[model samples]
Target: MPLTKEQVIETLRQVNYPGYSRDIVSFGLIQKLDVSDEMIRVHLVVRSTDNNVAQTIKRDVEAKLKEAYPAAKHEVVSEIQEPPQFKTTASETAGKEKFLAGIKHKVAVASGKGGVGKSTVAVNLAVALVKLGKKVGLLDADIYGPSIPLMLGVDEKPLYDGKKIQTIEKYGVHLMSLGFLIDNSEAVIWRGALVHRALQQLMSDVAWPELDIILFDMPPGTGDAQLTLSQSVSLDGAVIVSTPQDVALIDAIKGVQMFRKVNVPIMGIIENMSYFVCPHCGERTDIFDHGGVAKVCAQLETELLGEVPIDARIREGGDGGKPIVAMDPESPQSKVFLEIAQKMYDKIENQ
Candidate 1:
């Protein structure tokens, strides 16, 4: 059989970053790969000041490749990228505190994969927190595909008064997203470097008022955005969102593991699209199969915060920019979000 790039990647998965349980693949260290029947090669960009870390990774990757393909020629090349050097003056440090001073807690609502309604949960949760009379801010961190503006029905750009960007206010929550700044016809095709800089500005350059918490509706997967956020702010913790299925749960597990590897607390797991209930008949059905997240929680030993059913009303609210939590607080769907928000707050305070 001919050697393939996918096969090489799968083989490299056996190599883990030194002292961490996660492999270099999930960290996105592998920059390039070339594979054929006779030769297999991989290029890695290691973000470590220690040259030993890069050399160890190269050695481990080469060993894994050779072990997997004994007869194939293996070449492992790596570029050791030391962390950036930056000088923060006293005034610059004070400026950072000025913008971030008002915030109390920063939480990231993230998913391992997309299409799991992660943003929906974030948008509604922020409003639900407001319903409890807690000041809240929602920073849409999905720069490539910012959806908070559309979901929160925010069409106008925020006020930028020379110094800082004042976030938009909607549904009793402060909001900021790349979607709000760009035209609807525009598409953001930013690279990793640009995405990192944008996230830094969104978090520290914005003039956010005093609030109970700031929920970062993170982009799916562990990529540049996630890396920048982890490094930029002192994150209180992270909430992983997932559906009740193997495919989705598979990525969900990765999300949890990634945070754990980074030493970030797992606030809890939210089982979205957990089940469906017939509105007319009032009979419940396990549309996506039930308790899959609970099973993952048990395996990961993480809290199962709450379950959000597959409700068309939730979808409609998300599409219509009315977030069911604020649009219909009396509804059962809204109550679930309300309860989840409270649970998140409690954990935040105690931890």
Candidate 2:
């Protein structure tokens, strides 16, 4: 017996967003549906960037369809809607004049939640861009949990040249972070206003060299720090990082919406720790389950820049104050970072 559109729809109705009560079919995520003989094709439009949700929906839909008709063949087509465009205001233009004067592009590495390796992405991305022969600078704007210093192996305090503070140079990229100023044991317990002031100082007071790009390692969340940075500079765009999980995707969605609200162009999404490859046996494992970020990016109409699998060496490199891209440029992992960097550079250049 041939499959029917109603049967396919009913099958899809079994799949739901991880944290939501609504099913894919009921949410109007099914943009197009076709049924012919034993074959079925579905075009799905999802709004969340959670790769797991999308994969789950696709898997369930296909599985149920096959269960109903053993001879059924099916295909799922997904489309992500682009975020709404926001017009820049006069004040926004004025804000850009205060900092980042000579830099060609300023990009932010952000995430909805912490522990998604946002800083690691920023550090390696900056290093990758540098390897591509472009000058770059990295600013650790995560005042409370600044890890840029540890990741880049920078320990000395920034020097002052009377006119402005001098950034430390390492691996062909300039660096700045609150980690350089305060003692590692001490906590940044300042109020929101104080945090903003310090960030302002980092931008306006630093004697950053003329460079092709500056990447800000932003703190996680849609908080005051993010707002301050977005409102303080003319950010070229933002790259969101997330893992292939529902919790992380929920936050990633918030981060994307926040950037859109503030008028920062979203360059794309990157899935960090998308999967794990065992060293001894070379077996692949979806440690956190995969494809959530890709689905989210599709729904948001943003690019899925690339995916970085879970590797022990990546963690070891960061702890040793060396990013994989700089320490092992020829490694497969390093190539991933370089490729993502190239995509970003191309996007900025084309813009």
Candidate 3:
């Protein structure tokens, strides 16, 4: 029997990338797969620059296919994408530099995995900074799942002047997000190259006002988008957000290592949903296993800036398109965000 595309995909699904739970096929690594007359041609793009990782993936694909079809001829074409370009002297790079000239600092709030409240942290941190009397801008770089527009209560589409995009403002923070550009039901099905281009435009083409700092709400994982942002603009530092669970902490380590490899300074880690405070009695419970983040931070020698308890008000505020800091600045949950923002600002100032 001749090999089918479905069969080939099923075989390739067994090939997992190093250090990640997702396989190559599901990770969007298998760009092209052609099978005809027992000959299989596979084209894949891996995000890592490591030659060993690429060779391993190639070997795994070929081995799996050969095992499935003894008479098959398999050809694996693999390419490693170069990291984002950072040089600013060249004419091509000069535009990117000029785009970021007005902002004094650029910080990325990132996580190695999803469901860590990374975007929530990014939004509140930006708002808290605004409360502290600094001119701030927030860019939602999580193209696949942008939530800043919803979180900040901005539902209207952004207006673009001929040359630059006009950002929507709410609660004293200038905001831009992919959510504002597309309808809620619309899905973003962009390739790595297109994603990189969209992110570049989000930073450079947006008519961002002069500000003390701009916070980038980055998408989860150490993939193309993360690399694109780190390379395209000069980042002052990055803040890693994670829950206190062992699984989240494990992935948070990867987030730290990724920033270090890109030469971006680690601002510190924020443990979100660290605990739950009973509304009736005010008793704090270790809902997700407490102190895991602190232990990881100690081992990594990075500061554990603060811990935000799991609060229903926080969730409600986010769902209502109003962050806690902006909705109720006097609340305990809001104060936590404010303190983290101040710590971050102080660290940047001292450095």
| Top candidate, metric lDDT | 2
- TM-scores for candidates 1 onward, in order: 0.73, 0.79, 0.74
Prediction 2 TM-score vs. true: 0.79
Flag clash pairs in model 2.
Answer: 48-296, 49-296, 50-292, 51-291, 51-292, 51-293, 52-292, 80-298, 80-299
Model 1 residue pairs with clashes? none
Better model by TM-score, 2 or 3? 2
Across residues 1-351, which tens digit of lDDT does each residue of candidate 1 receive? 777898888888878766555688977899999899999878999864467778999999988887889998988899986433344356644544534667999899999999999999999999999999899999999997999988988888789899988989998999889887778888888878999888888877788898989999999998888877766666789999999877787788778777766556789999999989898999999988888888677656689999999999999999999999998999999999999999999999998
lDDT per residue (tens digit) for residues 249-276 in model 3: 7688788888877778888999999999
Best by TM-score: 2
lDDT of 2 by residue, 1-351 (tens): 556778677877877764545577767789999898767888877655555556776776677767766676778776655456578788879877779799889999999999999998899999999999999999999998999999988888889988998999999889999899899989887768997899999999999889999999999999988989988999999999999888788789889999998889899999999999889998999999888888677767789999998998899889989999999999989999999999999999998
lDDT of 2: 0.87
lDDT of each: 0.86, 0.87, 0.86
Q: Which stretches of candidate 3 lie over 4 Å from their true place?
A: 1-96
Error of 3 at 305 (Å): 1.0
Q: Name the runs in model 2 displaced over 4 angstroms.
A: 1-15, 18-86
Provide the lDDT at 147 for model 1. Answer: 93
